[model samples]
Target: MRTKDENMRVLVAEDEEVLAELVATGLRRAGFAVDTVYSGDAALAYLGLHDYDVVVLDRDLPRVHGDEVARRLVADASRTRILMLTASASMEDRVQGLDLGADDYLGKPFEFPELVSRVRALRRRSARPVPPVLERHGLRLDTVRRTAHRDGQELDLSPKEFAVLQILLEADGATVSAEELLERAWDANADPFTGAVRVAMSKLRGKLGEPALIRTVQGVGYAL
Candidate 1:
């Protein structure tokens, strides 16, 4: 039974024909949409044509190298999760693989059932709710957790700043005015001349670092 989630597509990049076939077959039986490629170069080419929810990559790949592939994918503007598979079980290898952007690592001689579990994890990660994941250019908000990240680093935000960010995110790129923000984020009864919004915006921009991704609309509120 292919659960609604299990229908997610995956890419398998492995040079060994038998092992790649085995993974593809097992994944298909477990209700995943899978495409298998024999080399790193081929994997990149496949990705150019199809978007996958997850990628099962072999560490020992020809031409492209699994670690490089994972790095490139992570740097790209896509949300594809990668699981690295290999025979080397050394700690250094594992850490290096993770540092290169592999979400999960599986040393070879593993069972099919376990691979299914990791695949599920990868899919979940791809669909994971994020509050600050939405951004235009350099600003992103992790919505689910109410955190912010700029250029891959976390941003420290005050409670009020976070609330203001939420309003902008909910607006979905539409311009929001100060009146609306004051009414929605704070109280209409509060002192508007205190420059509360400006203060918060200043701190937020400082944390985010210029050139600012958020824009001022001249006498209005702000736009993301």
Candidate 2:
């Protein structure tokens, strides 16, 4: 149910102005809506306020560090897809970033086309058709319907918003990856920096209220 135009939202968290601008322009030219920030703090604030499809993050960011930002995002129920780009190509660094909950880890000097393709792949995984209704932690979800009721209270939800919640509840209290959410909630032609998933989850949390049923697993995904 996603059109080409409907899937273009990207967030770039790179400290270098030239690199950030280049990425932003390239994304725009590729038929995507893009936002670029110079630091991890700015990126996190932007994520809190806006909805995007994917996030392009730099590993070495100022004002909170890219790794910390990634952690915060994972803690967020929205579970946005993150692509960590680092100048370091060390296998250890790659493994660490993946362990830090980034959906994709690309070393510097990566091909632009590969990044774009990865973005699309992440999107497809999120939006694909999967079992919508699921139960966990005493919550019931009818994902496509966007209606949730835990203990008989009618919990209203928007489409993208509920998708985030579904991912958490269906997690069965296990850590669910951000990349997995991207693939399951959107189309393969999705932008990796889009923050829509995060925005949706924020609204969902507001609707649910109290005790925060969703818990953050540090560098891991959300659990019920």
Candidate 3:
């Protein structure tokens, strides 16, 4: 099966807890790392702490207001893309959102698939975008297809393992710290002290097999 996007991090900022959770679940199932907040203040707090690929924001939000959140993010020159959401689908609303620096806008009661499509599109327009397939040495990973192969033999991999591998390949031989891997692959709730990265790396190496391609930089992190 083909996957269209990597584990791009996303934030869902909507006051309606039910809708927010539903959106988060769908995005997570579609292979994106997602976090949710009920207020604009919490949204901004999360934004300050994490480098989200996109924010699925509600225009009419509690506390800080979605417009102010977008304005602040833009003023700070943050690279995170904004996909403004609202109950109103008026032309004026769309234009206002775009004018406020939102990368895209979606009204409420929208289809889940369209939201996924928009998020993927925003990731492509990010500061760094990866190709559908990545190859280094004898290893080949199809990010879009969600498959990995070594010397033409397909390898079985878990979701986390696939995400970690994609991050390493995207690094292009540069040593990626475990912290960076967790931030990109896991949600905000992931504990930094947890050995999640180590566990995932070990399994990934075993699946890759033969001469180990992943290298540890001692005090540093991991590289291809």
Candidate 4:
């Protein structure tokens, strides 16, 4: 199926810089293109600029305040999903956040893994259902089984390679930027200056031999 990072984007709004950065790092490691803002207003501005799959918002935010941000996002009724966070873990607080149109809620002092899982769940809800299998250009991918075949021959691929290929297939011949590939296939900690994407692409191309299926757009990105 589609991984959390496959074309999925996330916005993290937290007043606390350290916590916000930590959360952003974790989500990025989990393979999401994550952006962080320290205030609710910044979050709103970023939301206006880009379409995100999910937003991890802290209730206690400066500037516009988290509650108002959630309200405005709900009113917009954009496809962006929200996961509200707060130190107040009371039943009433949980109900109130949900009432404000938050797709999910988590209290402060939460586990990092749990936050990642919740974000992924919210992203799945916001994204269109992924097809079980994808086939194009002599390549066939079984998303459910996590397998790939070309010209009826099985292709052994690493997790990163598989993820990269899936993104290209989903693009349907559209050029995918190298930055986009790194965001979706690698973690936030990946060194942007490194040749990680290039190496992985080389390996992938080697495996999917014959007539080149992937084409480089020269500074634009790669298209298949």
Ranking by lDDT: 3, 4, 1, 2
Task: Tell me the spans in candidate 1 whose CA falls farther than 4 Å from its real position.
Answer: 1-6, 128-224
Candidate 3 structure quality by residue, lDDT tens digits, 62-167? 8999999999999999888999999999999999999999999998889999999998898888655688889998889997778999999999988778888888
RMSD of 3: 3.9
Candidate 4's residue-wise lDDT over 116-214, tens digit each? Answer: 889878877897755778999889998657789999999998767888898899888889888888776664457878989999999999999989999
1 or 3, which is superior by TM-score? 3
Candidate 1 — worst ten consecutive residues by lDDT sum?
1-10
Candidate 2: list runs displaced more than 4 Å: 1-5, 129-224
Native-referenced Cα lDDT, model 4: 0.85
- lDDT for model 2 comes to 0.72
Q: How much lDDT does candidate 1 score?
A: 0.74
What does candidate 1's lDDT look like per residue over 10-126, in tens digits? 788989999898988787655455778999999888777666778999988999898778878988956788989989988999999999988999998898889988987777788
lDDT of 2 by residue, 1-224 (tens): 22221233678899999998898777665545577899988999888866666899999999889999988888885546888999999999999999988989889988888887787656545444345567765577764354788767888665556656765665556676565566555533456688655655567778878767876567665667
Model-by-model lDDT, in order? 0.74, 0.72, 0.88, 0.85
- C-alpha positional error of residue 80 in candidate 2 after TM-score superposition, expressed in Å: 1.2
Better of 2 and 3 by lDDT: 3
* Clash count of each predicted structure: 9, 27, 1, 0
